[model samples]
Target: MKILLIEDDLDLGNGVRIALADHGFDVVWVRQQEDALRQLDTGACELVLLDLGLPDGDGMRILVRLRHERQNLPVIILSARDALEDRLRGLDGGADDYLVKPFVLAELLSRVKALARRSYGFDGDMLEVRGLTLHVPTRRVMIGERTVELTASEYALLKLLMVRADRVVTRRLLEDEALPGAHENASNALDVHMGNLRRKIGEGFVRTVRGVGYVVDTAAPYKVGE
Candidate 1:
């Protein structure tokens, strides 16, 4: 998952960034609201951790602007304001979750996971497509009684495809999700990964769209070629 953290406190920001990164999340930290807005414009972040106080402007204003522009992007308020009215205002202004200052990192991480699951329309950490099961939090894949081990990159790629199962996921989207902050490689690299993934998961699990990209056919049973 990719997260944009808009925080001004160097110590707190670094700590949060490190913790989230350790949990397999790509985090981009920006101390200023302008930088946060710029990152949003790139359409790279899956979630936003916004502080109510920013160097350039109020963080709430950024949240309002984001909702005004892209209403679907999940925004979680991370601020020191613990007042009831403050929490109410944040939610009313389109913040998905509110975290008061001096919160535990575990709680913050949990909230992030919850928000991500909600955004993806997942009922829990486990993602089910046909008979294949992917445990998002544990990064485990189960095909019937057999367990499949996957590298981080492979897991990332599979997760992206599985989340958007039955829909065509373009190579550009997969590349962005798999490798954030890196130059895009040729399509052949993705093809190689997909090839390996299909072999491990089962042949015909992921269908290629020729010139388009790939899609996980959740409605179809896994079938090896004739």
Candidate 2:
């Protein structure tokens, strides 16, 4: 998952970024609301962890602007304000969830997962592409009864693909999801990860669309190979 963290506190922002990255999420941390708005324009972030107080401007304004433009993007207010009116205003202004300061990282993670599930209608941590199963929480892949172990990058790539199964996911999209708000290392980096994933899963599991991008062949038959 890719997240945009809008927090002015340098230490908190860095800590959240590192923690989320360690938990297999691509996070882009911005200290100011303006930068957060700019990053949102790229349409790469799946979620936003926004602070109500920002250096440049009020984060509520950013939230309002985002809802005015794209109402479906999930935004969770992460701030110190615990007043009932503040929480009410945030929700009324289009925030998906609210988290106060000194919150547990685990709770924040759970909220992100909940938002993803609500957005995609995924019932559990396991993402299903036809018969292939990817357990997101465990980073485990199951092709029938046999299990395939994938590296962290490979797991991340596969999860992204499965979330949008049968859709052509561009290299740019993959790269953005891998490293949010940063320039991609190379054009072939996605290909390398995809190749590694395919080798572990199966040859025909993923398909290349020539100059377009790649797609997971959700209809292909897969079995546990001994």
Candidate with best lDDT: 1
State, as a TM-score between 0 and 1, how close model 1 is to the true structure.
0.75
Candidate 1 clashes: the total is 0
* Tens digits of per-residue lDDT for model 1, 1-226: 6789999999999999998877767689999988988999877677899999887899988988999888988898999999999999999999999999998998998888788777754433667777788876688899987899988888988887776667677777777778553335444677677888888998757888887778887677545793
lDDT of 2 by residue, 109-201 (tens): 788778867765343356877678887667788999889988777887888777766667777777776644333444566767788788888
RMSD of each: 4.3, 5.4
TM-score of each candidate structure, all chains considered together: 0.75, 0.70
**Model 1: which residue pairs collide?**
none
* Model 1 residue 73 CA deviation in Å: 2.0
Q: Identify the leading candidate in terms of TM-score.
A: 1
Report the poorest 10 consecutive residues by lDDT, candidate 2: 178-187
Candidate 2 has what TM-score?
Answer: 0.70
